[model samples]
Target: MKILSLPALLFSLVSVSEAKKFQRCEVTTTMRKAGLDLYYGYSLENWICMAYYGSKFNSGAVSGSNRHGSQNYGIFQISSRWWCSDGKGKTANGCRIPCSKLMDDDLQDDILCAKRIVRDRKRRMNA
Candidate 1:
């Protein structure tokens, strides 16, 4: 029988918990196909830049508390205060999704939520 050391087991577990980060070009291509390239009149470079600054393309990224005691989630760092529910505070939940969903490997839900946020912002600005 083979025995694994405790450190090795912990390392494996930690690695499993870490999310995969997208390359800049890969993110650009995916967002382009998702129609996010110019969804909010923002270019592909803009989206890539936001993704890089927000979470460094890490789908599992979660931010610490903001001034409103809300956190940001996922690659775009969508706020828990307005976009999705984090279950520990009040949220408008404009995306109508659990914040954890945004952290998944699949980005469909994240993209949808981002679009909703952008639309809402545009509406507010136009109003």
Candidate 2:
């Protein structure tokens, strides 16, 4: 026969904070899903590195203004002056997308805008 003790602990509760940012692995996976493995001579690693350096994989990151006062948005830190419209200043609206769309957890619009930026850059270089 065994006697139970009142002080015996059954299990300890672990407190885990909610994740507000994506891990590097998650960023890579998302980039791959967006079909940008080698798009425009940029490898998957290159894209991942960009996200890490740009916003530490935070999808809602917004960067400060550059010398031209153009802010960047999202994990890729897309520019507002030329690519996306921040509605704060004049923009070319090359992507025809609002900057707010880039600063969300959803990445579809961000990836599409990134593709457009790259494609447009290529066009300008060859022209």
Candidate 3:
């Protein structure tokens, strides 16, 4: 039997932790289950469209930096400028989470943060 080196083992674990791209139907189902079907008055189809365009249903997707020097992370492509902390720059951290967490397969945090973004947008529009 061969033993794996510590770095190799860690690398394997990290690779396993990477997120996956969900199918369109699967994304819709998940959104519905999370009570996001009609969240913020947006239909389920609308959310699906956003996710598709933003990350092509890729939960682990990370975008290149924008002109503002901020990058987007995760399925919804939440920006690091105001949503998440990248640990190397200043951010509002509205989601109060590490940017890396958004890249995980689990999407509960991502959904919550997305909801927060929508709510903030609604509030701003109302104001």
TM-score of 3: 0.81
List, residue by residue over 63-93, the lDDT tens digit for candidate 3.
9888778899998888898889998677899
* lDDT, candidate 1, 20-50, per-residue tens: 6888888888899999877768777877888
Q: Once model 1 is optimally superposed onto the true structure by TM-score, how far is the C-alpha of residue 87 displaced, in angstroms? A: 0.4
Candidate 1 positional error at 97, Å: 0.5
Give RMSD to native, each candidate: 5.1, 9.6, 3.8
After TM-score superposition, the amount by which residue 83's alpha carbon in candidate 2 deviates from its true location, in angstroms, is 0.6
Each model's lDDT comes to 0.82, 0.78, 0.84
Ranking of all predicted structures according to lDDT, beginning with the best and ending with the worst? 3, 1, 2
Give candidate 2 regions above 4 Å deviation. Answer: 1-20, 122-127
What TM-score, to 2 decimals, does candidate 1 have?
0.79
Pairs of residues at least 3 apart in sequence or in different chains that clash in candidate 3: none
Model 1 sits at a Cα RMSD from the real structure of 5.1
Which of candidates 2 and 3 reaches a greater TM-score? 3
TM-scores of the candidates are 0.79, 0.77, 0.81
